[model samples]
Target chain A: MTQPTLGVWDVAAVSALLLINGALSVWLSLGIARQLLVAALRMVAQLAAVGALLTVLFGAASPIWTLAMASAMVLFAGYEVTARQTRRLAGGWGPGLGTATMALAAATVTLVALVGPLRPDPWHEARVAIPLFGMILGNAMTGVGLGLDTLTTAVVRDRAALDARIALGAPRFEALRPVIREAMRRGLIPVINAMAACGVVFLPGMMTGQILAGAPPGDAVLYQVLIMILIAGATGLGLLGAIVGGAWRLTDHRHRLRLDRLAPARPAS
Target chain B: MTNAEILTLRGLTSTALKDCNLTVAPGEIVVVQGPSGSGKSLLLRAIADLDPHQGAAWLGPLDRARMSGPAWRRMVRYVAAEPAWWADRVGDHMRHPKRAAELAVSLGLAADCLDWPVTRLSTGEKQRLGLARALEDHPPVLLLDEPTAALDDAATRAVEALLKRRRDDGVAMVLVTHSDAQAARLANRRLMIRDGCLRDAVS
Candidate 1:
């Protein structure tokens, strides 16, 4: 039950649907016509680039190439994490630590899934490894970034409260216990929400893509469930790493809240 | 204890305070008067090891650098002007509710105010509770920054009495205040800070 392939005219015909949307935007004075066109163009270009790369990758199916692509994906995701942070650690620590933790989490979970359950041919096949690694890295990066950003912001905003606790004889960890918990929760919320809303509220992208590619509905559901669980696990690990590492880097042995280590918050765009 | 330890700040400099040298004797009160932004608060923060500064500070023979920041802070507690409360219930912060009760009674807080939510506390209440919370740690040296600034005359007198009692109990105190009358009433020696330098105020 394979899906039919789209020819060039079919793509042009499908793209015409976007014209209707653009026309409606123009008619409504939404001022989003340019944005819609630009976004559509970007999507087409990005997908084409990705399609070309994937075709080469699938043909090669070499472990080294798969690992290299995975590494590149993790690196890009890590950069996105650091760039998204409102209040970040100064210097290389923010991005360096973030990337390190996200990679650790994504790699660990992906390996477990590959070896344990979804053992594809050659185990590290590009088709299985790249997409799995991509999903884990992308999700874990967001989680860790949220954790670090929230922790820093909370520390800065509640510094007086933290100092008061320290003054009252709280140890460093004890003083920061609440902030750390809040940060971890913030990091986990996205994954949790996705899990909660899966199947009932929305069909996840991976499941839809799998079904569109003519995979069995039951198989797609099973894979989606496994991926969601793996994402949650990766997110948890990455977030914990970021918060603990961030907390350690932000303070010294003397238990002083060395907020000086944090780069100043950037103004909202 | 140990001949009433002395707190000495020698050539301490921060962005706010210049090479300031001063000594505070245990059981003695040194009132610091200064214009706003004159670094009175910064002086206390530096001595408490809360901020980076040049030079040295010592409690008797123990150098500030020799001990951890927490250790130094535990010995020399700084009560900021606007204290912070993180806990929902006021009693959650009190290590010694019995002592707090006694202090609260003296400070005019209701008997059960400890059980009240911190969000319900007024600024004056928070200020008084901040003092009580600091005292719970029983720091040997006290760096008070305008502790009574938010209080009324009667409340101010009550705080003065409480602080004077602590002074008599052999606690070294550096009182940062703007009130000349408070200096006259409580200080054995009064110092004025202007342009980050400390000078002895004429009695």
Candidate 2:
């Protein structure tokens, strides 16, 4: 069944339904009316902008443009990941490592999807490639960021134990075994939880979008599952790669943990 | 193994020590006495290669330059005042569980206590167990920083006796302590750190 399209007046009439919540918030003294309105406005603006850009790109369907857009998105994602870290590598190493890892993970997974499963008529179809690239890179970025943050914080907080392990004849990997394990576990948790909740608790965003755009529920569900699997794989690999790279930068050839390589974290409020 | 090797540090400089030169032969115990925050612990850490420093340290003919950090640490063990144990089970940290059990028994810990979680251990118990863990490696030289500070008289005596046994077995030791009696009892040579300079303690 084809879903009915919402024109300008239809969208406006439905958007006005938010006024009911705004009135309720005012009556309850919630003070969230302004925030609610501002958030809705920002969401509209961002989505509209992305929609326009996607429209143009999909029409052009140029592989070069698609690649360039994917690169830009991955670069931004990398920057966001590094920026979110509480304790990151000093100088350019943290961002550089994050960008490289994210790019590698996202590109690898997107290519596999494009060539292996999706197998679109034209290999670099903008609609298929861009969204897949964005989803993979976006999830991988968060995973890498979480892993780096957790490992760095663990290093600083459990420094005494780490040194003690080293002093007790443990090699570098052995000394960091616990922290590394915890970091990777924390990194992979988001994707794992999303996978668990996808169909049972709530329909995932990708599946909902596809169903809303007139795809069959079964097809959307299958695609969503496949995408989640790819996300989990990419995120896990990205986290492991980024953490190992960051860890290497934090130590020397002699297996000494060099705190100097880390930017000092600000004290929590 | 080799008879009575020496731990020699020459021109060693760290946040705690400056151009420090010292040597302790196997079977010798050098007690370092100093005021609080006098870098006594840092000196021990420097010798253990846990901290960055200038100058060279040698375990007999083995130079610090020639050995990996872990290898150097294994030969020269540093037991901090507050020991850090990463494992939940005490036995997990011991390289030699049987030797650890023997040391634990001598240090007034039950042999089965190794299987106990670290959270179940008291401060004194943990400290004593930490000593056992370090000694399990059978380091040639031991750097001790107030190792018995948290113990009572009986516990302190138990630790002191175990250390004395290690000394008799030709394990060179640098012991940093504030206890004058401990210094008096254990020192083959007593040195005091004042303003970062090592000098002979006043008799």
Candidate 3:
């Protein structure tokens, strides 16, 4: 059975609940009334636009259309990754490295899931492939972004120690081992926490959405488990690629710490 | 052109230093004296291959460019003016704790100083330990920047004596110092740097 559809009035009724936030801002003199209004409006408009695009994409149901949308999402995620950094790599490497790693990891996992387990009639079915790709890409992007930021920041912070180690005859990778481990830990912690807390602490958004869409709870639970595993795999791969690639970029063949390759850190805002 | 030189720099140029040439025979110390920000540290860093430079440095016949950075650095160790210690405990930074403890005692550090947390170190104590860490390996060449800048008269003498012993063991050195008296006591040849240019200091 299909889930009940949401009408304009039903959406408006929920939207009106935001008035409580606006009223709270006004009463508390929080000075966030305008910001709250603008943010809510932006969310509504953006989601509405995405919904319209998805309707057309579902109607087309072509692999090319699905892949095109996925590419667009990955590109946007790449920008987000770089934008989130405090000290980005100099040159276009910040965006280039993030986009390349995220795309490689997320796409690989998504393709494997589509072909192996889901086995949709058309393996690249827009509905199944796009959402799966999107979910994996979102998590992978966050992991890669955090990993890269940590790598660059740590390299700068530990410049003297790294140089000392290098001077003491340690190989570049050996000298960077501590920083790389820290970056990997930072990137993977969120996914690990989410996995641990999924059923007991909170139902994941994907499973909640699936249950609301009238799917069997068992099926939805299985989907959530599969998706979570895929996300973890993608995030781990992405973080490894990004951090390793970053390490390579930050040092030269001479094994000197190439701080010049990093943009000077912006003063803390 | 003789093979007697353990370390040789031919036209080394860094961003802060102009083209420079020098050589140090085994058991010799070449003291570099300069005002602050006059590229003394940069000169040593370039020789150690820590900074990018435009010149050739040879450890005997082995050209620096031909060697891996770590291998080159291992052979030609550069101990910074304010050395960095990575680990929490003092002994963790040393490759050989037994030998380092011996060296530390010679440098006027307590016998148990190696077991002390790094946070407990005074600047003078850290300086001595940093020297001990570098000397533990007995590299062929030492590029030392102000090795005793933080030490008092007695501690400075202790460090100088240790450096003299290293030299007597055939380790060549390039030492940066601000004190003329220290240079006179340690240097086989003294050079002064100003505005990135190196010139022999009059005796």
Which scores higher on lDDT, 1 or 3?
Answer: 3
C-alpha RMSD over true interface residues, model 2: 1.3
Best by DockQ: 3
- On TM-score, who's better, 1 or 3? 3
Model 1 CA deviation exceeding 4 Å by range:
A1-24, B1-4
Tens-place lDDT per residue, model 3, B1-203, is: 11234798999887798988898999999999989999999999988888777999898889888889999898898998888888899988988999999999999889999999999999999898988998897788999999999999999999999999888888899999999999999999999988788899888
Please identify which of the two predictions, 2 or 3, would achieve the higher TM-score against the true structure. 3
Query: iRMS for model 3?
Result: 0.9
Residue pairs of candidate 1 with colliding backbone atoms = none
**TM-score of predicted chain A against the true chain A, for each candidate:** 0.92, 0.90, 0.95
Tens digit per residue, CA lDDT, model 3, A174-232: 89998999999999988999999999999999999889989999999999999999999
Residue A133 lDDT (model 1) = 88
lDDT of 1 by residue, A84-169 (tens): 88888999997898999989989999999999999987898888888898888888987898888889999999999987777655
Instruction: In angstroms, give how far residue A178 of model 3 lies from its true place.
Output: 1.5
lDDT, model 3, position B126: 89
On the 0 to 100 scale, the lDDT of residue A206 in model 1 is 97
lDDT of 2 by residue, A83-196 (tens): 888888888887888889878988999899999999996989999999998998889988888888898888888888988887776667778888899989989988988888
Fraction of native Cα-Cα interface contacts (under 8 Å, chains A and B) also present in model 2: 0.64
Candidates sorted by DockQ, descending order? 3, 2, 1
